[model samples]
Target: MTETTPYDADRARFTRQALARLVLCDHAVAVADGAAGLVATENDPDAGPGGRVSQAFQLIELAERALVSAVTYERERGSSWAEIGQYLGMDPAEAEERFAADLDGWNTAFDVPYRLDDTGLKRVPQLPTAAYDPVSACARLDTWAGNRLVLVNDEHPVSSGLTMAAPKP
Candidate 1:
């Protein structure tokens, strides 16, 4: 079997650049901020493209951060390792084994089951639809936005809002 790849070639390169910026600023969000925070944790050249588990886990972490978006987001509806791997022509079980290493740390809280659909927000409104594809939808939006506004659209549990603790020192 081929070794698991972490991210696509372009993503790996972009992440390398982002991480380079992020590391220089240390771990300060005020100094780092938004996409900068993403860049911060990704700067390890030692990681390489095949080290995407590290990068994906970091993104999984930051997406849940409230100060960043005030809402926990799960791209499971849009993207998952198994799903991505399948799209890339790999076995789901094998794909998971290669990149699921980060689950040990992330599992401390909760790790979501990959869902093909969370009741069809795609077509049936409240029922799961066989035809919905979140990844494709987001891809179109990104293209329409001139590739400037990239996002992983997903369903969120509605809350009154969120409360955040002070950033760690």
Candidate 2:
């Protein structure tokens, strides 16, 4: 049997929230870059429109993933399905149904953190890369949030603070 380290337990407790914030931060960065690209294109007469449209499509996909992560975070934090449904303009049952699989997968990742690869020599994490390696996710999300959120202190940003608050199992 594989033993869970103190670090592994801590990571399992907090990775979901960190990953959610990471996705949101990534989406925000991409949106900012897309806006800058649009401005640059506006000034250049030779710039084309198709690339921007494609970028917009990609942003939509990122936004969808961010939404899923947000829902997962909310569920983990004990938010009611009705509350989520209210915000999403859907029935509570529908909201729960829509996100059930995502929440299940998130929970399962904590239980089974990794699986043997096809080669049977390497292990692949069940959680998303950002969630699997939470230290990097915290650093990235905290830096991004610290730069953007006025309430987030530069020295101790949101994600780092959350890591400190991870629940003991």
Winner by lDDT? 2
Among all candidates shown, the one with the greatest TM-score: 2
Model 1 C-alpha RMSD to native: 20.1
lDDT of model 2 at position 13: 61
For residues 1-169, write the lDDT of model 2, one tens digit per residue: 2435335744666645556555555555666656556556455555465766776777777667778877876776678999999999999999999988988887887788777899998777777656666677667766766776777556656564452445565
Q: Report the lDDT of model 1 for residue 18.
A: 29
What are the per-model numbers of colliding residue pairs?
5, 0
**Residue ranges of candidate 1 with Cα displaced over 4 Å:** 1-82, 109-169
- For model 1, how does the per-residue alpha-carbon lDDT over 22-128 read when each residue is reduced to its tens digit? 22212223222444434555566666785656656665565443211110122222346555566548876765664454333233222221223567342212101
lDDT of 1: 0.33
Residue 65's C-alpha lDDT in candidate 1?
A: 38
Which window of ten consecutive residues has the lowest lDDT sum in model 2? 1-10
